[model samples]
Target: MGKSATAATLALAAARTGRSVLLVEVAGRSATAPMFGAEPPGYEEREVYDDADGGSVRCRSITPDDALVEWLSTHGFRRIVRRMARSGLLEVIATATPGVKDLLVLGRIKALEADDDADLIIVDAPAAGHALGFLRAPVGVRDTARTGVLNRQAREVLEMLGDPGRCRVMLVSIPEETPVNELVETSFAVEDEIGLALGPVVINGIVPPLEGLDEPLPSGPPPGVSDVELTEMGAAARLRRERVALQGEQLDRLAERLPLQQLRLPQVFGTTLGPDELRTLSDALLEGVGSLEAWA
Candidate 1:
């Protein structure tokens, strides 16, 4: 996945099919805001993209601190919540507890899932390492706490996460050595360790096939070009071609190893991705996945 770019594109793809989609950023990163040209979202979901058919994409960034506050408020601890926020006790609790932070974040997601505000809730989870921990947090808590509200909450979250119909974890990767390797390991961890149904793997930033590149390079620049510049350009092109070939090999390896559906998104060359680029990627995604109804 291109991370935020991929998340935003997927959300847009769902919204284009006249479905309400909620994009959640669980890594405390703000990728959807900039993609939609809006300010960073807080705990509250805000409409980032509105489809012509009355469907929309709402995005929110969920952090441990904010989730804790929300939890406290819901439990009739508004005064305590304010004091904790002012004294930085919230941060302390979020930091001190190993998996509690992740639990709180998932709790928030569970609330959204129960609310049924959107047809699809796409969580732009953390990277593979932290994401694995996040998904496993509930199970860890459930096992540690024999009896309590915490144990009950953890069980509920675990059920939702493990449900095949409700939850699907999608892994995103670039066609490279390190990222692909990490993705392969992460996929195993998701199914084996986390016990969740893994969804499609989106291979992002794939280099398109370069046509007419089999011919040998010219001896020199065609006109008004220095030898040094031409040589450097040739080297760069050769490197790009080599990288594309290597990426293809990596993709093949991933396909062979993992049985999940694979989708490829071409590398969009641009400094910033706007709606136009996102639309293009979304179309590619729909084409690869077959239909939006399938995702829902």
Candidate 2:
């Protein structure tokens, strides 16, 4: 679905507004760093892009194990953090408890939010199913802990997740049947179940409609083009036309079902997704942002 690329583009878009942006990946995949032409960043945030107008983008990756160790160390359990890690107790605990790992990661993000480290933070969350679990972790912990530091931390994380002014989920999806269906379902789950506010949906990988796709192929091959080559070209053109029509249908259906504004990103071809690609997508993202009433 190009979520990582979209996150990087969004970081660039936000940075262009003279706001510092932090791009965070919770799944431990340092996908954003590569797009910025940088090496993978670990737990420490590293500057990826610097805007001329005093804004910039930084990126970091957070894993559940690392978060848990840090959480324990900061919460007065520092003495046991090493032991727990060395003995693999941390993994056991995280696996046994359904949402503990997610809660730890969210807690760290909550702390970052509280510290005012960046003007805007874009989290490259996991896929739809895990994202739901990730958002719901704080709630589960808050309920289970009830009256301790853990509960307090969970409550604070929930506050961050639920507050629209502080945070909002931007869902990314390709224009297709199953993905669109999942996006709609996830939006509802986030709103109805988690009560988290949503930002504009990003529709990635839109293939621009070619002007002459509907016209018939030439009756005969041109110079240097064989009949077989022409036939293949016609077939490819037909596929493109069908794909464009299908994407249009899905986009319309998405608007009717989701009702939120969408930011459409053109399908990038042939490029290896480096700084140049980020700039192109960022420009497109900013244009889409400009059209939204809230952003304007």
Candidate 3:
């Protein structure tokens, strides 16, 4: 599925069962807010929409001030994150490349996602670098301090991440070579260094219809086809077919290496995608890999 698709899945997964969850939009261009129909975006925990039954799916603020303060408070760090913020630490850190911002954000996300009773908490993590910060934060803290509030917080976050029963890392990427390569590289790096379990690799924006492959190839000698036209069309069709086949093969390799669940989403042939599109993506995600309903 696409990022929006994954976000929707995680959101519903959070509310699955009888737990309350927060879909934290901490960083990046588009957070999960768009998936649920929150517009005129702001930085505060607001209920944009609800599950089928209309229960709230909280959209939290992404501003530094809010992220630090709220995260500390909810994660029992009302003072710690605040103190860090006041000391200019959080500010300086937030100003760093996005990945760092993601650590702090995920720490907060973990605060909410970590709730035992909560079904799932989806955080639209920062870019690859920023996300790495969150994924590897535990190692930094665990090796640095013997004891302290930050240390404790880091430890809790680390433990939560390390435990497979609780946390799962979903690496999102396109079927293209670059993104696929990065996904594989990121997976190995995260696992070997952080000892974190990489759950599913979501391959988004898959290409041209493959479910129609055997229906007499769009290439095979068309009725009354000219040699020249047939040659070009056949070549194009063959290339398209090869690309799709390669994506599937690569995806299979990724799944085998990590033994991660693969969620592939078809290319949306739309001029633009908004809430309606997100809803569509969300529906596709839920159609399989069923999880808790957002309002359950």
Candidate 4:
């Protein structure tokens, strides 16, 4: 973990377009702030959003419940649910079933970017496993709710998801066996089931091979090492390189299904970057693409 990282790359990339971005994360353990050098107090949108290169990116986090309830209220949901929370029932209201949580998380992302003031909404979403569940949410809720406010919003979200111009789902994964397998499934699920438009894949923590060493290098360590220490010395680095290979293979498979735009970033440094790293990320993503493209 000696190199600079780009955990908030997507968020910074989206915000660089002069759009008001709603960078959302599902995990209770916050991971996004250090990429930007500071955390907001709970949910407040701090004005001076600085990146590693000393630039600015605005971000906000909303709980899954808040996202849904706010979207409903904004799009005209009945007050019973929104009001009950006001009457001192956060524990009661926020603790809905898992499906309900998924519904709200997506609804918030969809609704927040509707206003003229807002431009982009980058979701850190859940990590590999739950992240797929988060994408499956619209269809899942639509089928189960059947009728009423839940069903209606489910329909709206799903419709938006299907339109390639409105929503784009992207995957972030390290090049490793388990995550690569999960991403393959995610690609299939988004197309066949949830019916979402997908964009390029971001391959995080890619280990760089020595540049310009064209011929395939020898597999073993330097000539002067004992076998035991050689095994230990090479283990971690070997695994890291193996993951980079795994990512390349996964991207090739994913490309057969769709246009796979890939961004490869090295492992993060022990001491995180401030505005400087954010700028590097923003520049990297914008090097080829224009907008974040909510849709394909």
Which parts of model 3 are misplaced by more than 4 Å?
A: 1-5, 12-21, 28-30, 54-56, 70-103, 113-118, 208-239, 290-296
lDDT for predicted candidate 4 compared with the true structure? 0.63
Each prediction's whole-model lDDT (CA): 0.86, 0.90, 0.64, 0.63
- Cα lDDT tens digits for candidate 1, 1-296: 57778889889989998999999998877878778777778888888899899779999999888888988888888868888889988889776546889999999899999998899999998877688888889888888777987788899999999999999988999998889889999989999988999888899998887775666778768788888888887787888889889998999899888877788888999899988889889989989888423543
Residue 71's C-alpha lDDT in candidate 1?
87
TM-scores of all models? 0.92, 0.95, 0.72, 0.71
What is the C-alpha local distance difference test score of candidate 3? 0.64
Question: Which wins on TM-score, candidate 1 or candidate 2?
Answer: 2
Clashes of each: 2, 0, 6, 12
lDDT for position 246 in model 3: 83
Per-residue lDDT over 46-101 for candidate 2, one digit per residue giving the tens place of the 0 to 100 score: 99888899999999999988888888788798998899889999899777656778
User: Per lDDT, what order, best first?
Assistant: 2, 1, 3, 4
Candidate 2 accuracy as TM-score: 0.95
Which lDDT tens digits does candidate 3 get at residues 1-296? Answer: 25555665556544433345666555644456666666635664666556665444666656555666665577676657766866887677555433334445556666666454344566666567666776776567556655765567667878888888777777888876677778888888888877887666677787865455444545456678877886786577777788889887777776666666676666666866556776566565655456423210
Query: Where's the lowest-lDDT run of ten residues in candidate 2?
Result: 287-296
- lDDT score, residue 83, model 4? 69
**How well does candidate 3 score on lDDT at residue 65?**
58
Please name the candidate that would achieve the greatest TM-score relative to the true structure.
2
Worst 10 residues of 3 by lDDT: 287-296
Which scores greater on lDDT, model 1 or model 4?
1
2 or 4: which has the higher lDDT?
2
